[model samples]
Target: IMAVPGPSLFTLRDTSQKVVRYHHNRLVASPQTANAPPGGLQISVVPNQFMDPSHFPIIMGINGGTRCLSCGTSAQPTLMLEVSTHHWGVRPRAF
Candidate 1:
């Protein structure tokens, strides 16, 4: 649920900022801050102004626990997460 600047969020860029690969709906990147743990899938979402800020970036553990990740303040627009659930309609978690 991290917020990125625009539709170019998943456009994998090289060190020179050249487009490496465009990943539709998903991305893999390291966090910009040191407080966060590494490695997780980053899926794109449509912008939703009605969403609660606290609900952004919902984090889950492999043990099935749920949590949240805060990416700090950003002037860039962000996407809202409706839910990350299983086919059975239950939300999922990760380790």
Candidate 2:
């Protein structure tokens, strides 16, 4: 699992237009190889308000690349953002 610093309150609108707030200052993502469809990968994000802050780590995970079988070209790699449950108390103040 990879964790990175994130916003204090991640507010997003749900399908019903209600704003959802997550009390987390970090994001965490974990990538697992999908075996059902060969060469498939699945990434999961964690760190909600309910999670304990002390156990989470602060790091980030990035996917390398996927090469095309025929053309020998590689697909662009993606960096996943996984936040930690712990609050760093280093948020930027409004200017």
The TM-score that candidate 2 achieves is: 0.18
**lDDT by residue for model 1 (21-89), tens:** 213533334433455433333323333323345644322122122322212124674533344344566
- Give model 1's TM-score versus the native structure: 0.21
Write the residue-wise lDDT of candidate 2 on 1-95 in tens digits: 33546423222334554432212532222222353223222222334332334534222121321210111112553323333324665522212
Q: Which stretches of candidate 2 lie over 4 Å from their true place?
A: 1-38, 57-95
lDDT of each: 0.35, 0.29
Which candidate ranks first by lDDT, i.e. highest? 1
Could you tell me which residue pairs clash in candidate 1? 60-94, 61-94, 61-95, 62-94, 62-95
